[model samples]
Target chain A: MTTEAPERRGARTESPAKFRGNPWSGRVSAIAYPAVFLLLVVLLWWGATSTGMAPPYILPSPEDTWAALSENGAYLALHTWVTAVETIIGFLIAAVVGVGMAVIMVYSRTLERTFYPIILFAQVIPKIAIAPLFIVWLGFGPEPKVLVAVLMAFFPIVIAGISGLRSVDPEALELASIMGGSRWKTFIKIRFPAALPELLSGLKVAATLAVTGAVVGEFVGANEGLGYVILQANGNLDTAMLFAALIIMSALGVLLFLILEVIERISIPWHASHRNKDA
Target chain B: MMTVETPSPSTAVETDTLVDVDDITIRFDSKKSSVVALRGVSLQIQQGEFIAIVGPSGCGKSTLLRAISGITSTTEGSVSLRGDQVVGPRQDVGFVFQRPALMPWRDVRRNILLQAEMRGMDRVEARERCEDLIQFTGLTGFEKSLPHQLSGGMQQRAALCRSLLHQPDVLLMDEPFGALDALTREKMNVEMQRMWRERDMTAALVTHSVAEAVYLATRVVVMGARPGHVVEEFTVNLPRERDYEETMEDPEFHRVAGRVRELLGSASSHE
Candidate 1:
């Protein structure tokens, strides 16, 4: 009810002060918790190894894992690069295909009706089960891995984009109409921005799945990559190396997710999820 | 002076037909059933008049507004603005929805200038339009704030400014202030009253509140339930220049409010 007074001439209201960031809390989130969890896991692994609850061939000690890591660093790093390339290529393919599908689906009801059911059915079919078949068809090269990643990653983006485009508020459209806006203008200006929060949510899910889909394809047939390393390590009875590969894969996923989250925060400052009123 | 000029119908008696809603009817269809939203409804608005269309929830008040904007076309009749038939969206008509419906991504200034940007207005003009409007709505400092950042009252104020940015002759508002708290509502009512008087723009606001109808409107057009039609129209006898202090205290305002409330009550019972 109170009036909003204008700032003094040549001055403006400061952007709601960037969330009064608590660097202390960030330390807890980044260092303390991770340190504790890593310590706990290391302790558990050491205890299990020392107690001889399981044989050495099955679960190795923390030191054995470190030795394995040190011995295979060069080989693992090369294999890790292979996985990273496959993931990036596959994710890009999925993004392009998904964005194309979404654009077509948004612009044409006929396309949406024709393809929506088929895409949904494809999503329902397990991607892992399809991975070996993809490898059979496309051979042991990177093609199969990239294809599987696309299969896994495309659905969320398509669904997110469709709902984002379609779920534009009727009132906002009406406002655009009254303003003499064309359909495209309304889509670009209102629907696009409003759908950002949902679109980013779907992207996070899709991107994480992109890595998994690529690795699944790698598991079926690949001469390199983290998935290949894990498979070989398991075959050679090297549990530590397998665990290390798994850890690296998890780190990769987390890194991609954090990057996407950062982008969302920056691009959509107006989004309620990112706003800091307490600041 | 008499010998030099003659007044045209457009200039002289816009009072009869500032807005001619000619026999508009609307129907919606689904697999199971068909619903008739409006039937052969017609209305005429006048210059600088503040009219309130009061009706039940499903009485097609919003539907009628939509028809005027051509968001949904009438099965039967056409809306004409300034003697021109409104086939599609006419830039001359401004619409304010029930919800503020502000774009969450755009700040108040950018939101208000959305209409201008859509019309491809130049930057200077758009800025001027936004600045002038923000000030008019008492939202000067909220220029850089997004819709979610603003309170309900402030959001609606931004909505109002957005609607008026193009300076449309006929402003159609569908309960723009319906979602606010009572105290905020009262404050908005007072601010809106001031805006309405200053703008001298013809406005038709659809509202369920009788007190809101009484306070801001020059005429209250009472509407009935489904297959909505105007039941009665009351000409407000209050002074042209209404102050917040004198308005609530004035017995005439109370009398008008009460009568409109009774009309709304009876309309519901009849349905």
Candidate 2:
């Protein structure tokens, strides 16, 4: 019985995570199919306009949008820079403030009980609705736009931080206690590190919304930015330009979101869930 | 990992009482229910005694050990170490839980040094101690390896090193080998006995395995279930310097082991 134990246990080395799972091509198809579908849509769009099914004003087609984007690339870039600056600054503020608030909540149970629901309530009040109110208060400057982004981005962070801080394994805590760790030491070493992976997940979601927040703020009250450019183009019936601006905004969101993911990969490399794909 | 080849074992050099856990009774009360974890359990652990406390699940074997280490407060008792009342965790008592409980973020070397850093030991001295601990544990090459990277046995070894690094007087282990394969567990048990004999450091291990208790303990305490207490204590008349096979095969070892198994079987049947 003991002799057989060695082989039985050794056999467990061939884990279920082996077999290379399904090939990466299955996943690649997910991305590839979307791209192909999008290309087909664009082709149909160009075909519709070329066949004069829709007027140039109604649907300007892909070439017209590309032409518009190329023509205003420098001007659009300037507007993009405004939105980018606002988004980054607002995100930084939200990150610092959110984490700070979460620390306070983690340290005190009373604060968590008193303020957590209120924070969620603040998050639920649509950011676009609040954007106009912020514009009314802070005036039509970029301040309101940044403030809107900060508000939109902060809730996810706070909730993430709270859950992460509270989600520490009781067993790990017992080990730390045995090691004679103080509250601060335990939080820094155990609670904080455990919370990190969860908090990053929240930050990624917040980043997507943060870009949208900037645009919404601009839409409410702005003389500049992609949102303002879209409004101006709409007023002039430049549907192609409006679409180009929208695409650029989405691209920016995707770019920023991917960057956070990359940083998460590099920083918390030990996390099993954060392991990179084989491709 | 606690592999101390004590060619000359460290006898209780300090002629002082190391631990005095007096008249402990632990109870839990909630709105709907009340659970008794321990009832009037009293124990005094001397220096350099490898004491194994055995019982069934929820027998308060863990609770009793917790009270001893000052990890859990006693409802109706006081634990004194060096004649000081233990209200909270003390810096000197090392605890090895059933789980390795190693930090996921840190590598094995860093996990071992965690307690040393917390105690404000000199960084240079701490690093030197870590080197010695790694060598002793047969983990010299696995210094930079993370916890997830190592085997379960290896991780537990690192955890042992972590607890032992602070050089506490008493090492409180709560079924530290409960999660290991039998072969690895046997190897660890042998290693642990060797270290205990070498260090002669006061230890209290809570285990369900009767064979393990008979093998490792100088005093195998069989605990009764459901509001547990020490029902019987067996003194193993095994040789002081134990060889693995020699001691297990001894008729005296079987007599003690059989008695413990009977006690455990009867205790649980009654509950």
Candidate 3:
């Protein structure tokens, strides 16, 4: 009876998610579909530019953009590294500060009531509107750019972290109480782990926003970053160079998102969202 | 007048009384109004006894269990465990909730060892006990499986393992099998009876199923609705070693189940 248990259980398998064959195939298609769409879009853009349907000044040909990229590859790489550093540093700071504030708010009702409205008020102020102010206060370096990145990335992390903390099942809280675990122990063991799914989602949102914050700060004051390069190219009417910088900027955002995804998969393999990935 | 059956010597007068709930009145108060969940309820629990509190919806059966576990505070009177007043959550009490309440992040083994990890028990000893409990609970091969990977019944069984891992003196369960199907619930009832017989802890289970109350508990307390209080108590005199098939057929089981069901009928009718 014990030996047949696996076969029986396997036979009774029912998943709400559509089964799409082996994990490799599932992963391949997930990337392949988006890749195919992007390739088609590129082909259409190239065709349109070659046919002179859109003027070169208004919409530069793909070859022109690619030529500009290769010509300024070294310079672009340096700026890319700078922007990446500022965004990553800003994102890390936001994660720590936001999650810390959320923890304090969760543990103390007085703090939540006192500070949560102020946080909302701060969030309501457009981050871009304050970028010039940050440049004035902090000057034209990575400092102002990183500050803008932190500002853009902070709200979602704090909001999502608080919601995650609050989402812990009351039964689990009662269980913790019954087990006689201290309040601190319960937070570390039960409450925090329970909050991971939401917290990771918040981090992902912040990661993407971090790149925007860094670029926006650079646009306001920085002398050397992808954002600065874009501003310079735009002023010069080098649309091809502008397109190249924009492509690199988007690549940076996607890279951050993918890195967060990998971290999430490693840290929370036991989460329900990961159950459909392989056996 | 409601019936308050006199306690038989075998149950109420045991020397090693582990819990004494003395006229615990629980009231939920808001700004506008106050609602009484439990009113003047008293019960004494002996060591190694399996007591089931059965009632209709809205009765304070669950509130009583929480009061004993110190999860819910009593408005009046006190609950004493081992001769000491339970001012807050007592260390030697274990609770099993209506749902499994298993942490989605932890696998079966880690979830079972949660009790030990929280209490700062020795690491090696905790691991050994966790393995023993997994085997005992028939979750041996699935130690690495997450809660979502298991069936509802298996998840509840894992929860049972978690509650029992610490070997608390008293186990308080509020409808632990209420979410499972009938077949699984019956199997869990048999499993619970076996666990209860093997262990030395006192347990108070709040349930709505009459057959379950009669089959697993040594004594069944019937409670009424509105301002909930005890209506009647019946001592089940069935044999200790009871199987699902044979026990349900036994005349003694039928008699006790019938009486309890009839009492529940009258209690609900009054409301």
Q: Against the hidden reference, what TM-scores do the models get?
A: 0.89, 0.91, 0.95
The C-alpha local distance difference test score for the whole of candidate 2 amounts to 0.82
lDDT (C-alpha, whole model) for all candidates:
0.80, 0.82, 0.88
Ranking by TM-score, best first?
3, 2, 1
Instruction: Supply the TM-score of chain A against the true chain A for every candidate structure.
Output: 0.86, 0.87, 0.92
Residues A1-279 of candidate 2 have per-residue lDDT tens digits of: 112211222323345337447668657886999999999999999999999999988888889999989999899999999999899888889989998898899889999899888898998998888788898899988999999899999999998988888888887787777677788888887889989998998899889888988999999989999999999999999999988998899998999899999988887888877543432
Number of clashes found in candidate 1 = 0
- State in Å the error of residue B191, model 2: 1.3
TM-score of 2: 0.91
Off by over 4 Å in 2: A1-41, A44-55, B1-16
Error of 3 at A51 (Å): 1.4
- Lowest-scoring 10 consecutive residues by lDDT in candidate 1 chain A? A5-14
Using alpha carbons, what is the TM-score of model 1? 0.89
Give the best candidate by lDDT: 3
Superior candidate under DockQ, 1 versus 3:
3
List, residue by residue over B1-271, the lDDT tens digit for candidate 1: 0011223223454555778788888889899998899887877778788888888889888888877777777778888877788887677788888789888888888888888889887889778878888777778777887776667777888888888887888888888888878877878888778778877878888888888888898887777767777666777778778887788889988877787788788878876
As a whole number from 0 to 100, the lDDT of residue A8 in candidate 1 is: 27
